[model samples]
Target: MYTTLLENIPMLFNDPTRDFVAGIIDAEGNLQILKKGSIRLVVVNTNVTILSAVRRVLADIGIEIAIRPYGKPKGNERQRYRVVIYGRGNVEKVLKVIPLQHPKFFSIPLFSSPSWGRKSGNERDPRPQLLPPPPGGGHIGGTAAV
Candidate 1:
């Protein structure tokens, strides 16, 4: 809602003592509030060579990503990766390294799921999932380097 000029004329002040009063009036008139929801971001087909750089960038930009390093075969050209990012605000600035047009890199919004228990939105932290059983007779998420 906007106020008319005549109705606002009483708010205009020239005396130094009225500065504080004018400020309060302006602040009260201009006050705005926001309503928001959580969002879950998932990074698919990311490049592992830039993982550390990407992590720093995300942290600096106030977004958190769960890092799950997938292994590469011997003599592979570049390390392929899958990272999950979760947040509520715009994160495209932090994801500048990703090629927005290419299919090899993309981000998706992961919605909250009641089945996941403790529903997950863009705000929830991500954990590694669907990893293959380790060789040498062990389970995943152990002390294995990617």
Candidate 2:
């Protein structure tokens, strides 16, 4: 079903296509801050066709990405394709077009902040501090503990 829909999507990125990509990001994407505070946007899926369509849509808007195999498939598991938008410039571009509707949204500002990823002296990290674990020590809600 999704393959057919993605295959037929217009090459140009319209509002509906933007919203659809945003939905895909909200569900399957990872807004990652690497160990050195560099930001990366990754959308993972089992279907390469869907990710190919996503890559084309993003390319139309001048954002580039690389599609690669995420992990080795286990028994009976499908191979996962990772569409990665690397570097601050690419991440910033993606954020402008696709507004993430998740708690990860809070991290968006960090990417745009002046202090983010800076190595100068005396400036505190712009990344949000992680909250302490819940009372029971289980995972927090769907959102990360922030």
Compare the candidates by TM-score and give the number of the best one.
Answer: 2
Clashing residue pairs in candidate 1 (N, C-alpha, C atoms within 3 angstroms)? 39-122, 40-122
* Candidate 2 Cα misplacement greater than 4 A, ranges: 1-16, 107-146
Candidate 1: regions farther than 4 A off: 1-39, 45-47, 70-79, 90-146
Name the lDDT value of residue 60 in candidate 1: 52
lDDT of 2 by residue, 1-146 (tens): 99877765654233337767877787888665555455567789997877876887788789878789988999999999888787666766676666667666453344335344454687666553333322433311132321
The candidate scoring highest on lDDT is 2
C-alpha lDDT of residue 36 in model 2: 49
Give the Cα-based TM-score of candidate 2 against the true structure. 0.63
**Model 2 C-alpha lDDT versus the unseen true structure:** 0.65
Give the per-residue lDDT digits (tens) of candidate 1, residues 9-106: 44332221223322322222111111223223343333443344445455554656666755574685555455544332333332233223422122
